[model samples]
Target chain A: MKTGIVVFPGTWSDRDCAHALLEVLGEPVRFVDYRERDLGDLNLVILPGGFSYGDYLRCGAIARFTPVMNAVADFANRGGLVLGICNGFQILQEARLLPGALLRNASCEFRCEWVQLRVEQSDCAFTVDCRPGQVLRIPISHGEGNFFADPHTLESLEANGQIVFRYCTADGRITPEANPNGSLRNIAGVANARGNVLGLMPHPERACEPLLGGDDGLAIFRSAIHALNRVAV
Target chain B: MTYRAEVFVTLKPVVNDPAGLTIRGGLHALGFESVKDVRAGKYLSILLDEADEDQARSRVEEMARQLLANEVIEDFRIELQPEPALAESRGGGPS
Candidate 1:
């Protein structure tokens, strides 16, 4: 898989994502600065997490207006694969590429720790390798990861199976105590209606290596590879 | 002619009121026992680009919709006063 990581000024996870793709997944990965407007050569685009623009005004508010977002949106509109993590999720919301918005955590604090995410849907390229109800241990670090939408939208997401990941306890039970950000329905990730675009609060790249605690995240990247390989064949 | 607009945006009532709760607690400690609820919101005083009262009102309302407020979770109200009176009230010499 040829993956491109969008580098906003404060993107701290681009290197981690790139390294994970190259070193762990053995795929070609490149850094695409926010100024780069072309998406011609990339098979998958990853919007890594970070405190973009220092989270001023609102998280992802400033970063959403970047030049590259237009290209990214165009690419996604053309059925390209896109993955957004953490602040990247915020950007996706701000760009209106995804439904709902991210608000400040109910605790009103930055949460950073390993979290269990249950795969609710496996049809998405990013989760094709995952099984329904399967749980993956990943890291989530953010202050405004609380996902919110209107009741109608939430119902639609649930009905359409676009709700892909949810916060779960170690034993795989979904509860408020297990939801780190107080998101409605304990939603930690979601894909677009078409399932080509995905945005999640968890950092799968951070957990790709076994030394980092678990290899649960490796499957997410390998899933992308599997997707590309299938497309090529 | 000039117009002054006061715009207020506040969260919808159904939304959680954590900030308001904290303020109510502070007020109770300060002996303001009659204060049952206090919702915190933003207050903005904008100098209008137009002077006609109706025109200015519409313009400010448009601004509120486009930027000052998120229609999803908040609502805004606009009030317009003559800029000359606003300046006088501010203790500034007539313009």
Candidate 2:
């Protein structure tokens, strides 16, 4: 599987993601700068975390207009697997590749710590390795990770099972106390309708190794390879 | 003629505004009991190079739609302000 990670002007997690993919996941990943106009060659495109363009004018607004986004959008359109993490999630939403918007955290504080996430849908290519109802420990570091959607859109997302993950307790119980950002319905992640594009506010890349505290995030990277295999077969 | 436009962008009623709520709490703590609420939003001033007011308004409206405001959770309003005359000097004759 050919994998590539996008690097925006203010992106800081690209190297971390690269390390996880190369050393941990054993995937030969390449860096695609924000100025690149061709994403038609990759199987999986990862948008890593950070304050893109200094998060100015809005977190992802400026980056949405970058030449790279247009290619990413086109790649997603033709069924390429796209995974957006943290600020990457914000950019995906701003680019309109994913529905809903991420707002300021309800507590108005930048939270950086480990959190529990329940797998809501394991049918998508991005979460295919995770079992539905399984809880994974991940770290989230952001001040604006609140996920919000209009009533109709929210309802449709639920009905269509587009929600792929939710912030929850260690025991997999959904509660307001476990919601780090006060996202609607405790949603922490979502997959586009076709299930190829996934966006989540938590940094699974940060937890890909046991030395980092836990390797629960390994399943996501495993799922990426599995997705490619499924397509290849 | 250059036209000045002020744009106000705020979250929709159904969307939660955490920043605004925090500001409200700060105001209440400052002994301002009369302050019932605070809703924070973005304010931007755009200087237009177009000669016609209608044309400038339309262009700014497009800008707001495409970038200045997110249609999903926010609404935007635009107001045209009078252009500052270049002929006027600062402080107008030094008080």
Candidate 3:
């Protein structure tokens, strides 16, 4: 599968993301400069983590206006698959591609650590390889990863099975203390209503290399590849 | 014409404001006991060279909606008037 990774001016994870897909998953990867307007031919797009636009004015405020985001929004509107990691998630929220917003961590400090998140739904392409309640460790580093949505929106997300992942204990039970960034309902990731676009603050690419200690993130990428293959069939 | 644009962008009240909170704490320590709540945001003054007052007001409003503010969380107001014949005031134009 061919994947496109959007690299904004301050994007720091473009290489890691590309390497994860190309070297680890054996998929062709391309770097998508945020200044470029064309998406060309690609099956998936990944907006990797970084302090885009120096995270000024708000985490994702400035980066949302980049030329590439317009194309990314269009692609996702047409049912194209997209993954947003860390600051990318903030960008998605700032763009209104997803509901709610991210606030500073409850402790008002940047958090960097491996968090165990339970797969809430496995039917979507990104998590199809995971079983409900399956635990996977991924790294999260951000100051504005605290997700906030109104109670109504949260309820709708729950009823529609849109809540895809949540921080959980090693045994896969969700708890307040397990919440890494004070995200509402312990949400770690969520997909749009159509399930084509996903925004999460965890850096799955950071865990794709086994030499880095774990390759728990491989399944998410592999699942997307499989989903695309199945659709082609 | 001197176009008056007042830009007010505030975080949604529900969203916590670390900057505001820190400032509040400082104010308390400095003995500003009367201050109850503080929300910090940017105030922009823009000078417009539109043909008429109405056009300038409309243009400033467009800017507020598109760039100056996030419609979801912030609110803004605009005012337009003829420029002062003597001196250029430094506040309330556009941002």
Candidate 4:
């Protein structure tokens, strides 16, 4: 798969995603600058984490207007696989590529720690390799990861099965305490209505190497590659 | 003509405003017992050059809707008035 990672000003996780893709998954990667207007035939594009545009005005708010994001929107409209991580998730929401806005954590504090995620559905390209109801160890780091949506939007998302991950315990129990940022319905990640784009708050890129911690995140990347191959076939 | 606009972007009351909550807590600790609540919002003062005050009002409303405030979680109120003749003569709007 031709994979690209977008590098935005003030975005800190772009390198992390690149290293995970190249060193861990061995998926040769390209770096697309925020100023570029063309994505250039990339099959998979990622918006990595950190405070893009310094989280001014709102998280991911200012970065959404960058030149590259317009192209990213077009890429998703064409069914190109897009993955948004952490602040990237916020950007997707601001760009209207995803529904819902991420707000300040209910605790009003920045949280950075390991979390357990229950695989809600394995149907989307981002989660095709995950087992239904399986739990994976990942880490979340954010202050504004709380996800909120109106009742109508939430209901439709549930009905369409767009939710991909939820905060949960080690044994796969979804509880309030498991929810790190008070996200609605404990949502940690969700896919777009078309199922071609996904936005998640956790840092899977940071967990792909055992040297860092665990390798469960590698499966998420591997799953994307497998899904891409399936599409090629 | 120059027009002055006062725009406010406020969070929907139903939405949880974590920062506001923290500020409220601080107020309570400081013994401000009568404080009912504290909600954070954005305030913007914009000066516009338009044909008339009505045109400026409509233009600022669109600007607030599209960029100054997020329509999903926030509501914006715009108050517009023509700049005073003296201020207009000085090439400025009400600050």
Q: Score the docking of each candidate (DockQ).
A: 0.27, 0.82, 0.30, 0.62
Estimated TM-score per prediction? 0.86, 0.96, 0.88, 0.95
Residue A201 of model 2 has an lDDT of 91
How big is the positional error of residue B49 in model 1, measured in Å on the Cα after superposition?
4.4
* DockQ rank order: 2, 4, 3, 1
Chain A TM-score for each of the predictions: 0.98, 0.99, 0.98, 0.99
Model 1, chain B only, scores a TM-score of 0.82
Instruction: TM-score winner between 2 and 4, please give it.
Output: 2
List the pairs of residues colliding in candidate 1: none
By DockQ, who's the top model here? 2
Q: Assess the local accuracy of residue A82 in candidate 4 as a C-alpha lDDT between 0 and 100.
A: 95
Q: What TM-score does structure 4 among the candidates reach? A: 0.95
Predicted candidate 1 versus true structure: per-residue lDDT over B1-95, tens digit per residue: 56779999887776554567767888999999999898877799988657478888989998877566655556788878887765476656755
Q: How accurate is candidate 3 locally (lDDT)?
A: 0.85
Compared with the true structure, the alpha-carbon lDDT of candidate 4 equals: 0.90
Q: Flag clash pairs in model 3.
A: B2-B83, B5-B93, B45-B94, B46-B93, B46-B94
Candidate 1 regions with alpha-carbon error over 4 angstroms: B1-9, B22-35, B42-68, B77-95
Backbone clash pairs in model 2 (N, Cα, C under 3 Å; residues 3+ apart or in different chains), count: 0
Question: Which residue ranges in model 3 land beyond 4 Å of their true spot?
Answer: B2-4, B29-35, B77-95
CAPRI grade of model 4: medium
Q: Which scores better on lDDT, 2 or 3?
A: 2
- The positional error of residue B29 in candidate 3, measured at the CA in angstroms, is 4.7
**Tens-digit per-residue lDDT, B1-95, candidate 4:** 87889998898887889888889999999999789899988899998789877788889988887678876678889988877874557675555
